[model samples]
Target: MFFSKQWITGAGLALALLGGTPAWSADPAATTTAAPVAAAAAAAPAAAASAPASLDARVQDLKGDVIRLNRDLLVLEEELLFPASTQVALFVSMDVGKLFELDSVQIKLDDKLVTNYLYTPLEVQALHRGGVQRIYLGNLKAGKHEIVAFFTGKGPHERDYKRGTTIKFDKSTEPKYIELRIKDSQAKLQPEFEVKVWQ
Candidate 1:
């Protein structure tokens, strides 16, 4: 059990009140007066100790409420800005990337530049380890659209290489997801870029 300063003071006061008179010299009047004072003094410490515990619990509960509220706000904002019916997302990933070291990526939607991303060493290593990165998210109309992606990297033999790939697909009432993939071609000893539209 932990004792705060207030608790220790109250305990010492109660002890003083109860032990002030020796047993052999006890007087009825002194005993009666000291009993109530000692009791009240001891109760003060108990009440003081419980107050802080209750306050700490309320603080923890309030922190949990704030986190939940922030998450709800984020979801509401996303729905208002990019509804599912018109939403389009593009992702980048790598597979067996021994032949390439990715440095940057550029994406175009219908010939308009959408996103240009530069990768840090850690991010490139993550993709090489099978991690996928979402590079673009926006609203698109319900019609045919063309997406182009350009990947720049160091290819086999430590030479600079750049490649572009394109795909055309129709969007309806559902969200569209497209993946730009970089893969090592073992047979050709080179890196290949491909685009895939997910249904």
Candidate 2:
């Protein structure tokens, strides 16, 4: 059905050749002329084997486009809400979390608790697979600030553990990025958590 235009064009061309010729008085010549047109018409059925023109396929393509557009809009909204000049973001990552199993994390900015997050099993699994999760996002004025993070989880030997780490960072006019990286220390037989400030 999609080859309607091609078929019409081929048929129209054959009709024009059969009708508009001044020397079509010979039956042999007319047969020779119709042979190539018949061959072209026979090939038109191959269009049925091409890619789909179904409604479901078009709807699926539209859905994929909408998802990408929504992600872009969300990123734009975040930039507007937390402008880069004053934005401060904290992220958590795990590099082979063998010695510690993360349960929750509490962040304190300038001795005041700002954000606390409890990780689900799915989130922990995502981090174990080399995914980084953004735990906190806020704005800070241009000055020196201290960030204290309390990590509570299961330590070595399946013992309950809570460890606190601090980092003093100078907040400039640029956006500040801090990463709480938890990596296994095979040599020391423990997990090491550090606050890394991105320049």
Candidate 3:
């Protein structure tokens, strides 16, 4: 009921390759004529050669169809699971993170732990390079909600540092987006944590 695109494509190609071309016969009288028989014999090899090419084209067409189908399925699944009316997404980003070496993040929604994500060095570098990572996506009722985030890492002077930030926002029928940002404070020579709610 839920076969992946890769599995379906592989199985379809295997079936096509195994189903060889059917055999055809010419009438005995037709074969008796030298000119007609010679023509038919010459065309036979050409047809055989073209058969594989035709099958290959068909397999390529099927692959395209599978790719489109997979994309559609993912869109449908996301809509069903997290409708726009109640969807809430949280993202994490860093800006000029020279004072912090991020290690992990913990998020709490309405005082309940929602996510605790540990970051690898590559992921930290990506954030430093302006890549925004979606840390959570789920459904929340249309009302006021609170979110708390804790950022743990090494701060200026290579000292262990942890900071917590919180935000209270109201959600409407439209989707809600919240971004947790980490930035270096040049004036204070430390890392700053902020929560930005996007309208």
| Superposed model 3: Cα runs more than 4 Å off | 1-32, 39-46
> Quick one: best TM-score, which candidate?
1
Off by over 4 Å in 1: 1-33, 39-54
Over 135-186, each residue of candidate 1 has an lDDT whose tens digit, in order, gives 9999999999999889998999999999899899999989999999999898
For each candidate in turn, the TM-score is 0.79, 0.69, 0.75
Model 1, poorest ten-residue lDDT window? 18-27
lDDT digits (tens) for residues 1-199 of candidate 2: 4667677667667867777433433457767786788888887676554445565688899999999999999999999999988999999999999899999999999999998899999999999999998989999999999999999999999999898899999999999999999989999998888989988
Query: What is the lDDT ranking, best to worst?
Result: 1, 3, 2
1-199, model 3: which lDDT tens digit per residue?
Answer: 7889788667766754875221222345433565676799999999999999999999999999999999999999989999999999999999999999999999999999999999999999999999999999999999999999999999988999999999999989999999999998999998999989898
Q: What overall lDDT goes with each candidate model?
A: 0.91, 0.89, 0.90
User: What TM-score does model 2 achieve against the real structure?
Assistant: 0.69
What is the C-alpha local distance difference test score of candidate 3?
0.90
